[model samples]
Target: MQNAGDWTRRLREIGIYAVIGAFLTIISPYNGSGNLPLWGAYLYWTGLVLTGSLSAEATRTLMERTGRKFGVPVMLALMSVTSALAVTAMIILLEALTSGRSIPPGYLPRLFGLVWVIAAAVTAVGIMIERTVLAPVTEPVKGASPEETFLSRLPVKYRTAELYAVSAEDHYLRIHTSHGEELILMRLADAMRELAGADGLQVHRSWWVAKSAVRDTRKQGSKLSLVLPSGKEAPVSRTFQAEVKAAGLSA
Candidate 1:
């Protein structure tokens, strides 16, 4: 089932890029490339767009793995720069191979600028699609536990254990449960979607706690944290403190 979902997401992403590629082909932005035959132009833009998109995706994944949060605009800027560099290199190589000529050093910067524009546009579109089209449906399944979907991702021994909280550790998530704790390779953002049906709210950028698992609230100076059964504490960031209080977890 997980594999199926992954494939569906990949196909949708490819479709979105293909549409953008087609649009670029029609417009023919570059003066030299605009003179190419229709078929050749289509192939050129589509291939480049797909390659650039993949490069951007890889950059985004790498950034996420570093465990440092970035605002949307900053993230997009980083991805665009990385993708532009990769695509620019690809373009230079292809031109040299096909035309037996190297792009002049002075012209390389301009070529990168053009590629950056396309990369930024594609990155923005991909982010929008992820937030809208590919976001997980939060509705509960009929006749099933609210946490069923999320629990399914746990190891067999932990599947039936009551979920306590989840904390981010680099590119992995440390799952705390009634039985014990375990680690899984998944992003906190993606885990939140799977955990939507569970009775929990994100208490911090890196922590999500099940209301039932929060035994008490801990305060140190102006900071707040949620104490769980196993003596583990999940810090509640100022950003989410209001939500935690409103949910009665901070009481």
Candidate 2:
């Protein structure tokens, strides 16, 4: 379902490229064999943009996959490649469609070279903008919500008992605490994103317990449980029981 969101967002972005391609195709109408109408050109460009700019992971996921720290250069390159592919494919589709038939023999080379060069330019600009401006502005929006900030800046500390981690409850976050968990609203990934610095690990689809609050670790057969400070026990599935144990806590 979240991937559906990503797909939808990708299509919308490609559609923006299509819109630009439509304007350009109209500017210099292809005078080849077909002389396709403006709408057809637009549709072709849209489809092409969708094809070329297929879904790729967002900056964060890409970093995690690469097992390297996120790099400003890499992220910018990715975004630029994304934008250029979307833009280039749209242009090619328009050029081909206007020819009324097959893609031109010489089109492939130009498409390849143009995509890489333009992608580099776009990536550079995108990277510059993100590091210089966008990242600074958006950084606070991640977990530094107003309320969270207020809590952080409180005259007295308040988060001494909270436990945080991803919970896969139909794509929602189930935040656990000494007070027991309340599904405080957030995407599992986004919730994990905010909880990145906290000392907790996602142990299951329905749980994420803090190490400090783990009262006791007990196992019956293969199942393990994390007893909380309040005497409530949260199950630690086999998948993450090892992690809990490795963290020097019993399971």
Candidate 3:
């Protein structure tokens, strides 16, 4: 499934570059040499796209190690540098392979132009690559858990999601899912670390819920209850009210 997605994204990206390259061809003083060289350039662009998809996993690993979120901007910057370096290596290798020619040493003008053009093409590809590979995981979040945010372990399947909320029998968390809630021997903070790509917020000391599951927000005196979309009311303390509001959790 991922391979198909990657290929589909790559094809779309190639079409975009093809259109741009066509415009450049029209603008440049073209005499001959059909699409051979252009196709070669296209191949190089594909390499950058693959680099981006490959980087997505590595960047997720980086986030795990640093305990930080791998946002879009950071991912783009990393891929830009990576693609640029890869293009440079390709150019050097190509030059070495064709080194038997007696070409003039003072080809500075064309060399500089070629370098920038290739770099620009690779950078364009890098951006697209980052988008496809990182979109699902790096998407903006409505809220973050206080103990440990879901952004820590990204691009990985959470063994159990339906049970993201609910408390264990005692001193532990119970993740309630369609498959049924599971008793996890951990703290609210510790257990919150296992959740991502779900809705809900930590209203009180022990509750985390899916925002979509929230049916209504009701207040009585100074307290609140997050009425789950399922009709279950989870208490919301004053201390966590600000967070609840920030999640845009409707009342």
Candidate 4:
């Protein structure tokens, strides 16, 4: 489900970049500045800008996968620097080929420096659009009613109850809320998807607990478990011990 949302955002980003590229090309100050025809020049600029945008997105993805913690300024700096380098390299190569000019000695550095300035400008615009426009459009509004959020995914009777934990029982899931426990036909993975807005995580392959429902955590030798509001214990597998501890649920 997260991947679906990412894909949707990616498509929207591409569409936006394409439209901006077209607009920039139409009003380009450098149109027909060289041997290239006006139409060809426009196409070239539009394609170049779109290519740069895609490169920026790829860089952002790589940074995210690295999982390195960074503050806002640091993240922006890393992204902008990487994006500028990638786009500048591509632009230099493209310009050399399209302009039919041999790589001028001692001119490469100057060209790259100049191109980086342009790439930096484009990256700034892209970041602004993502934070101000795309983010607001994609993210649910703040202070949403609980009834309209993850709580609504429970069975009709349990909908208004306080959520505790979810346990996978073979092909079904057993939901334990404040009201009572009930078995439902659903996968833990799918249930987690529906509980996106909830503050929780899978403490084991078969168990997911709401942070608020955890009354205590216990460690028996190498194993860990969470004690819920209903006195039900949810085991935490070794695989998830780190996550449980990160949530400050470890004894």
TM-score each candidate. Answer: 0.63, 0.35, 0.37, 0.48
The prediction achieving the highest lDDT against the true structure is: 1
Indicate the TM-score of model 1. Answer: 0.63
Give per-residue CA lDDT, model 4, range 104-181, as digits (tens): 759767766665666677777777666445542223436764323544444356667888888998765777888777
lDDT of 3 by residue, 1-251 (tens): 56764676567756755654565445432221224476655444454344433544464456557644344446455645444455445545545555543324476445435545544455545444443443333223356442124332222334323333454345545554433333333566754555533455566777877666666778888878877544567887789888888888744
User: Model 1 off-target regions past 4 Å?
Assistant: 1-4, 137-144, 148-209, 213-215, 218-251
Candidate 3, superposed: residue stretches over 4 Å from native: 1-66, 100-154, 158-251
Order the candidate numbers by lDDT, best to worst: 1, 4, 2, 3
Residue 127 lDDT in candidate 1: 72
Q: How big is the RMSD of model 1?
A: 7.2
* Candidates arranged by TM-score, highest first: 1, 4, 3, 2
The lDDT per prediction is 0.80, 0.52, 0.51, 0.70
How many Å off is the CA of 123 in candidate 4?
1.2
- For TM-score, candidate 2 versus 4, the one ahead is 4
Position 222, candidate 1: lDDT: 95
Local accuracy of candidate 2 as per-residue lDDT tens digits, 1-251: 55653465456555555664565455533332145576765665445444443422254356555644333445556665666656565666666566555556687666666665644653454334323333212234465543243123111223443543334555334444433443323456655555566666767657766566777777788888877776766788778877877898772
What does the lDDT read for residue 104 in candidate 4? 72
Q: How does residue 90 of candidate 4 score in lDDT?
A: 67
Most TM-score-accurate candidate: 1
lDDT of 3: 0.51
